[model samples]
Target: MAMVCEGLVVDLRKLEELSCLEGRGMASHYYPPCPEADRTFGLIDHTDPGILTVLVQDNIGGLQVKSLRDECWVDVKPIPGALVVNVGDLL
Candidate 1:
């Protein structure tokens, strides 16, 4: 899930089109950046809108979420079997 967010940002760097992003390269198609708005990086430094985002990592993790107002990343500490679910919208 983290990589998906990072990939979107990276894709924005390569091509400005969000629609061009292929879900085949992603495990979760539900984590598209700016799903509604036709914009790139519009979701910068903000919390996720999804109720629960399931992330997949290859040994090392690759997700980075930040505070929108304060402008800082919320560092995730190492914890065994930790499934951090950032709640935003209603479940």
Candidate 2:
């Protein structure tokens, strides 16, 4: 995982002073089954403030990514043993 993260940082070569970069924090979320699923959100839509966001999702699918081209919320189907890497606003 460290190697993967390092490679990602290196790939952003345009960013100046890469050596000064560090991991800000780590987080994990658990969304339990809700009766009013349609009326509630486990996490509200927002842009990540950091450089990158690594999301590990379980089999319960609810993740959505807003499309820049269509302006629609698209479901992100969960795949076993897959990691979702998102480029944050800071990038």
Candidate 3:
């Protein structure tokens, strides 16, 4: 994950000081089967407060991202054994 973050920072042409970042944290989410899935959200839309977020999603698809340009909800399809990297607000 550290390598991924470093690569992203480099690709963005951002400051290279992020390579020295040492803080680490993790979280796991579980959503039960809901018959009325449309009426409720598994997770609310929000941005990570840290510099980056690496997500590992299950086969169940519910993740969405709000488009900054159009304010539309975009579905994030899950890929097996893949990680989704997101740039957080702090970056």
Candidate 4:
């Protein structure tokens, strides 16, 4: 992952020694049912500036991706045990 991200064919040990991946992390979010859900958004529509985003889907789905060709937001349905990878602008 580091090699591909950095565009370098270097040793893994050297990459780790450089501490290039120090702040990497994962996060989990929970949004309880809102009575006025239509009046607000948990997260505003925006673009991710990082390299990648991996999402683990729950039965209650709210993810959406905008289609450039159609110019609309499309719902992302979850498939059991399947991972959704979003390639960001940095990639």
Candidate 5:
């Protein structure tokens, strides 16, 4: 299970904690920082670790998913009355 927010402040300590205690540092993985080439549109990414993912956005469209190697970022522009789903690593 997980909680998500595009601009909400987070306390990492509140995470379910999949690993042992470790000092804080830049996360190797991230929901790509506000794309340098993207702004003034709407969103850039939507991510969270949960059994399933749900997104609710305004008219502003910009949600995207990055490709492997990050050579490109695919725009997953949101659509009305649609739900994008993903499977979590419940392993």
Candidate 6:
């Protein structure tokens, strides 16, 4: 995850004293099919609250990323055997 924050001010490179290994966790989510897909959202638009997030998308992808270049929420089309690395607020 620290690699995701490379060149940033809060780069977490030297974490020998931070007990980072003991403070780690993981999660999984499942979203059932929504009949009204346009009107509903499994998760609302939000920023990552952690240092970094490694996301593995399935074939039925619905991921989106806020594009800084265009200043828009762009749909992230998933590719097979790929991972999305999200840099978060905590850096």
Q: Which candidate comes out best when scored by lDDT? A: 2
Residue 25 lDDT, candidate 6, scale 0-100: 68
Question: Can you write out model 3's per-residue Cα lDDT over 21-82, one digit (the tens) per residue?
Answer: 56667787767668887787455667789877877777876779988899999988888568
Clashes of 4: 0
True lDDT of residue 84, candidate 4:
85
RMSD in angstroms between candidate 2 and the native structure over all alpha carbons? 3.9
Candidate 1: count the clashes.
0
* Candidate 5: tens digits of C-alpha lDDT, residues 1-91: 2343212345443344654224333323224335564453544455544434455543444567768886588877767556566543431
Cα deviation at 29, candidate 3, in Å, is 1.9
Model 4, poorest ten-residue lDDT window?
A: 12-21
* Candidate 1, lDDT over the whole model: 0.46
lDDT of 6 by residue, 1-91 (tens): 4653345545465443354445776777767667788897556779987666888877777888889898898888989569898876664
| The best candidate in terms of TM-score | 6
Residue-by-residue lDDT tens digits, candidate 1, 1-91: 3444465466433432433333323234334334444354323555555434555433233356776789787655535456655554422
Clashes of 6: 0
Shift in Å, residue 39, candidate 5: 5.8
Q: What local distance difference test score does each model get?
A: 0.46, 0.73, 0.71, 0.70, 0.48, 0.70
Model 5 residue 9 CA deviation in Å: 38
* Colliding residue pairs in candidate 4: none
Model 3: colliding residue pairs: none
Q: Name model 5 segments beyond 4 Å from true.
A: 1-47
* Candidate 4 lDDT by residue in tens digits, 1-91: 5655355556645545666456686777767667777897657888876556787777667789889999999988867567788776754
Which ranges in model 4 have alpha carbons more than 4 Å from their true place?
Answer: 2-22
Model 2: residue 53 alpha-carbon error in angstroms: 0.6
